[model samples]
Target: MSVDVTWLGHSTVTVDVRDTTGDTGGDPAGRLRIVTDPVLRAGLAHLRRRPRTPDPSASAGCDLALVSHLHHDHLDLPSLRRLRPAVLVTPPGASDWVRWRLRLPATRVLEVAVGGTAELELAGGAVRVSALPAHHAGHRTGSGLSRAPRDARAVEHLVRVPGAFPARAETDLLLWAVGDTGEFEASDAVLDAAGRAPDVALVPVGGWGHTLGPHHLDPRQAAELVARVRPVHSVPVHWGTLHPVALSRTMGDRFVDPGPRFVEHARRLGVPGAVHLPVGGRLTLDGTGQGTR
Candidate 1:
């Protein structure tokens, strides 16, 4: 059993797994497809395509699409509306909005809370997903900066409420956890729930703005995160997709080096099994209980 991951640049990866042991239809090809934080646009705002285009969507029909958080980049409604996968998973309490955004039925949605797990049967294979905690915030707001102590709450990254998900669900079994945070305040709890290591950790490394703060990780910090979660392998995303066009004109080609820098840092830190795939790559996975280690 083996898992192939195609880097879709800027953190989106297609995790293709083939479990030879499972009976996933007569064709083995159908059991492969994991779409993570997909941003398929050739250009967004000022950021242009840095890598190749993804394997044609028809050819890469998705089995499972993972949305690790609620940030705009990861939980993009525009991108989500494009794929017609067998199942879609997201953080707990986010099914409503996701369903609304795509006008999808509750039957196809799975919300996973941190520490929760759900089994899914798709394309003749059974897969499991568990919600792990992220320390970052998922503030859809990207305008205006507030530094006043009273206005500090304006950061708008984390949103916690009593079961305040986008909408309600009826009987979706697989829990699609939207791990929408990456802050230290809840990191311990997240660490406890996901165990000593994560099967697949989709972390954020860049921000919509120029600086890193209470919301997301920079290149160096992302490298450290890799050391922390220690998943089997990783693919970078969330940068270079929506950088300010004016910002690039000022910095030249070096403007979009953060993702590449992260790859370097992972290598420098001896990130065993880590692979940096260019955008639009394809992967197949075999979740036969053999972890990335």
Candidate 2:
């Protein structure tokens, strides 16, 4: 199969990355739009979502929706509910949570633990979604998707716990992909057991604050990830968008320049073709070559 991809900022992507042959046309023999962790709302606890926009209708009918982990930004219930996916691919036990919140039927949300995948048939054809890695956490505030006006001071809610240690940072536990981690694929064991690298991976390389944690892969690090996974083609996401509230713009370049950085890395790694598309731009790519319109 061949595929086309569009980067919709952050971890959210419109992946028509199906197995159909190349350039199958806009509709393609297979143009299944995969909404990976869509943070559709304006503000998360502290970060302001980017200005990037996709055809709202484009997300209307989807073959499958993939929630890589439970991070609030990644597994946003409000965003997921709007998409109205006929099928949802998520981590191990999180389905119960999504189901509880969205009131979606048990069959609608196909729950797969980390290192597992689910196959679904779409209009164009079939696509496989594998639960990969993400360096963030998740939660649904009692008051669903906030309705209050913006706090003139910051973009998201800030919690302060001066010296208390954070959970998920302790190596002793294998909690969901929440909390801080090094800027490495700290979970190689999961990657290896899958037996094959992801053809298209949606990874997190940014955070909700001025500082970046180790577990997150910044754009440059993302490029390194590309060098390792070496998918035939890739889309650099989780960057150049979304900023924390009350925080000054000082944490700029790390989030702003990751896209181009990935491109540079791809070149240095001899990754022949790593295409980074515009916010809503459409692309048809393959190992055959690269072109932009």
Candidate 3:
């Protein structure tokens, strides 16, 4: 019935879903918590978290954790160890990478391919997580020189909470996480996979450096994707969080401008649902399908 979205910084987000209908007989276990692409550290390689570091307990008690790709920033092992979610989902061939780092049981790690779906049954209801295509390169890399085997892949995710209400329009809460990617012709397949527009879309608008490559979306391109998905609420992420330590003095603007620029572009495109959350800010969606800050 109600959903809370917390942006910890960069691609990391926490989605908490509550059953406002009181159908769980007052059981607290009725709620579901999901985390995505958690990077909960002070610094990573040449990048340092701007503004401040994320709280160490930010990933505590997550039910499901989703990794979009094998990239270091997205599939951070230290963060995953802190999270220790009940179930961990990753793009194809990533489960092995996760196992190599963490000692999680094979049953706890799942590899999902594009268009594949996984279901989590909770005390209150059920959640469906579907993997969607992403246009970014799949292999893990460091400094653009060293690379991992080209077996891993990147993917977007669609999380749907069903049985919210009796009405068809309000029966489900659809949250789409468009992981790191570039614009592509098949991007429209997201609509077909979701079957309808999502209630909230987590869109990435920038990267950790001064220049963005063709593999990632810039603010303007992110705004365009927001217009196409047309979710009831859109949260701009993957920016204003991390930047190269050496460029901190000279490229401060790059660290803080993408989220606001995405908001501005979305406004110009007549998509006012875009919400620019500061790192650690939260957005709540009430039972009536309205999003409030």
Predictions in order: lDDT: 0.52, 0.53, 0.82
Candidate scoring better on lDDT of 2 and 3: 3
Can you rank all candidates by lDDT, best first? Answer: 3, 2, 1
C-alpha RMSD of each candidate structure in angstroms? 8.9, 11.6, 2.8
**Span of ten consecutive residues with least summed lDDT in model 2:** 152-161
lDDT of 2: 0.53
Return the clash pairs for model 3, or none. none
Best candidate according to TM-score = 3
Q: Report the lDDT tens digits of candidate 3 across residue range 217-269.
A: 99999999888878888999988888787677777688778999999999999
Candidate 1 has its poorest 10 consecutive residues by lDDT at 152-161
Number of the top candidate by lDDT?
3
Off by over 4 Å in 1: 19-29, 43-55, 142-203, 245-247, 251-256, 267-270, 281-293
Q: What lDDT is reached at residue 17 by model 1?
A: 51
Query: Using Cα atoms with residue i matched to residue i, what is each candidate's TM-score against the true structure?
Result: 0.69, 0.71, 0.91
